[model samples]
Target: MKQLLILGCLFISLGLIGQSEEETEIKNTINSFFSSFHAQDSVGMTSVVSKNVVLQTIGANKQRQQVLRQENFNDLIHAITSIPDSIKFEEKLLDYSIQVDGPMANAWTPYEFWLNNTFSHCGVNSFQLFKQEGQWKIIYLIDTRRREGCANQP
Candidate 1:
């Protein structure tokens, strides 16, 4: 009975370790994508996404009607790269909520967008990922952006 108890504890510890590792890897994958974004490196951003990844944004149109804007990955990359060097922007991500099941996971990140060190908007990002070939790759991404109803903090 004593040996069995010890083995049981060992297995539990190993399971916890596995979970910790998975969380770390998931966060790392997300961080890598942002790092690439801040650097304006299209290739780096593309490296972490699956070929068929979907991108969308939630925003209000000119008529104030809410709409989902689906974006092409390449077009986004082009836009980012085209930004003038004189301007600087960043999406500061706050907390991350993650869940995993087998080979898929989802992460929710609340963020503030800053332009030239001034807060422009705040929103949340939802990222869906798939474990492919032993690595996590982003499969879908959607985010909300709002100027009002946001606690803009530096």
Candidate 2:
């Protein structure tokens, strides 16, 4: 009976190890995407995302009404890569909350957006990913944007 308990514990440990590895892979994929974003490397960004990826944002319009805006993937890539060399911007991720089930995963990241070293806004990004051919690829991404209730604002 003692041996059986030890064996069961071993199996449980192995399962947790596998899950941890998968989580690491998922985090790496996200980090790679952001690295490419900061570098303005379109190809690198595309490599980690599905061809049919969808992007959206939750924000207020000019009249202060909440809206959900869908963005074209190609257009977004163009906008990011078209930034002038003199302009500086970054999305500083504060934390990550990731969950996985089989081949599907979701990552929630809270972030602060900075432009030219000044605070621009704060938000949370939710990413949906699928495992394709043994690699995680982002399938959908949506984020909220707001200027209030952010920590560390000056």
Candidate 3:
């Protein structure tokens, strides 16, 4: 009985450890998404996202647009490259919640983007990630952004 209990505890501990590692990897994947954007690394960004990825942006002008497929990817690459390298945008992942079931995961991360040290916007990024061949890749992303009023604090 004691041996059985020990084995059970070991199994539980291993499961917890595995979960912890997965969480860390997820966070890294999220971080990589932003880092790629900041660096204007099109290839790097594309590698993490799904081939049929969808991106939607809500601009300050109140215009909502959707980007799909290769055209979307090209547009993003162009937009990022157009930005002057001096105009640094720093993204902070303030909070994230993830749900995993089998080979699929969904994550929501509340984030703040800073441009030249000033808070530019805040939003919650929703991501649908799938485990493909033992790797996690973002299948869809829909992020909504709103300007930060003075009343808001990051």
Candidate 4:
């Protein structure tokens, strides 16, 4: 009985280790994407993203009505690259919750967007990734943006 219990525990430990490793890899992939985004490096950003990736956003319009917007990947790249050197922006990730099942994984990240050293908005980003040819690549990304419920908001 003791030997059987030990063997079972060993297998469980191995499985947990594998899961932890996968989670770390997924987090790294997302981090790489954000690093490229902050640098405005389109090439670097594309390296970790699938060619057919989808992007979307949920936010409020001028009248405070909620709206969903779908963005073309190429257009997003162009917009990022077109930013002037005088402007600075960042998405500060507050927390990450990731789950993996086989070749698919989802990462939920809450973040605060800052522009030119001022708080702009806060939201949560949902990133879906796939393990393609042994490498994790982002397949879909969506986020919510709101001026309320921000940590630093007055």
Model 3 alpha-carbon drift over 4 Å, by segment: 58-71, 148-154
Name the lDDT value of residue 14 in candidate 3. 100
**Each model's C-alpha lDDT?**
0.93, 0.95, 0.78, 0.96
Which candidate leads the pack in lDDT? Answer: 4
The TM-score obtained by model 4 is 0.98
Better of 2 and 3 by TM-score: 2
lDDT of 2 by residue, 10-109 (tens): 9999999999998899999999999999999999999999999999999989999999999999999999999998999899999989999999999999
Regarding lDDT, does 1 or 4 come out ahead? 4
Ranking by TM-score: 4, 2, 1, 3
Candidate 1, residues 1-154, lDDT tens digits: the string is: 9999999999999998887788788899999999999999998999999999999999999999889999999999999988999999999999999888878999999999999989999999999999999999999999998888887743
lDDT of 4 by residue, 48-99 (tens): 9999999999999999999999999999999999999999999999998999
Runs in model 2 lying further than 4 Å from the true structure: none
lDDT of 3 by residue, 12-94 (tens): 99988887777767777878888898898888888898888777664455353433222376688788878987788787888
TM-score of 3: 0.81
Clashing residue pairs, backbone N/CA/C < 3 A, model 1: none
What is the Å distance of residue 68 in model 3 from its true position? 14
Candidate 4 Cα outliers beyond 4 Å, as residue runs = none
- Per-candidate TM vs. native? 0.93, 0.97, 0.81, 0.98
